[model samples]
Target: MRVLLVEDNGDFALPCRQLLAALRGVQVVQTAASAQEACDWLRANPGGWDLVVVDLFLGQGHGFTVLRECAGRPPLQRAVVLSAYADETARQYARKAGADAFFSKTNEMDALLAYCLQLAGEVDGANR
Candidate 1:
């Protein structure tokens, strides 16, 4: 599975990468630190990613913009919001903007990984 990870914190990236590495069938992972970069990457590689994991507060832009950019993606393409600000309001907004799931960085890391693994399994199964 190909993933585009949109996160700004260098501190968080390494841990996230390590977690992803433990998952089977996660072939390629890309990172973007800003909303503009995420949008540009999506445009440049249209229908190229299997999953997108985004943070709400970016160094340059918000994750909502990235969600909007992914609104028209294929059914197999998934977008999820993993943010520190995972309040009810933020969750609702993320869902409205087109996120498949919203997880809190403070407490829901395991859930996020499980969801990713589920998606990866589905993709791998379908490809076979």
Candidate 2:
């Protein structure tokens, strides 16, 4: 699975990149630090990404804007929110903004990994 990871923090992005790279058949094709950059990249490369993992808070923009940018993507292309501010309100907004799933960085990291593994066909959804 080709992934576009939208995260500004090097601390989180580096570890997330390493983990995703360790997964079979999964590769993080690119990284964007802000919503505008991510949107521009997506526009420049239509159908170029299979998954976009976005953090709700970016250095230059909010992830909701990124989600909005990806709202019209094809069904095969998924946009998931990975954030520290993953409260109920945030989740509801994320869903409305076109996120396929929302996972909290502090509480649902395992679920995020499982979701990635399942998407990569490395594991079954039932297992996740």
Candidate 3:
């Protein structure tokens, strides 16, 4: 599973990268710190990524923009929002934008990992 992670904070990004790297079937993990960078990367890679994990509050711009950028992705490709500010409004907005799932950084880390694992298993099954 190839993942593009959009996050501004090094503190959060590092752990996320490490965790994803340790997961089975996660072959590549890329990082984009801002909305422009994320959008640019998404455009450049078209249907290259299997999954995108985005943070709502970025250093510049927002994850909603990134989600919008991913709106045209193939159905097999997935985007998820992982935010510190994962309130009801944010979750609804993310869903409306294009996010397949939303996870709170404070309390839903396990759920996020579980979702990723499920996606990875699917990818593995497809490859088999």
Task: Kindly indicate the candidate among 2 and 3 with the higher lDDT.
Answer: 3
Residue-level lDDT tens digits of model 3 in 1-128? 99999999999899998888788878555799999999999999986789999999998999999999999788779999999998899999999999999999999999988999999998778779
The alpha-carbon lDDT assigned to residue 41 of candidate 1 equals 97
Clashing residue pairs, candidate 1?
none
Estimate every model's Cα lDDT from 0 to 1. Answer: 0.91, 0.88, 0.91
lDDT tens per residue, model 1, 9-118: 98997788778777887855688999999999999998689999999999899999999999989888999999999999999999999999999999999998899889
* Candidate 3, lDDT over the whole model: 0.91
Tens digit of per-residue lDDT, candidate 2, span 1-128: 88999999999999998888898878899999988999999989887888899999898998989888887787668899999998999999999999999999998988988898888773233235
**Model 2 per-residue lDDT at 33:** 90
Model 1 worst lDDT window (10 residues): 20-29
For residue 21, give model 1's deviation from the true position in Å.
2.2
List TM-scores for all candidates, in order: 0.96, 0.92, 0.96
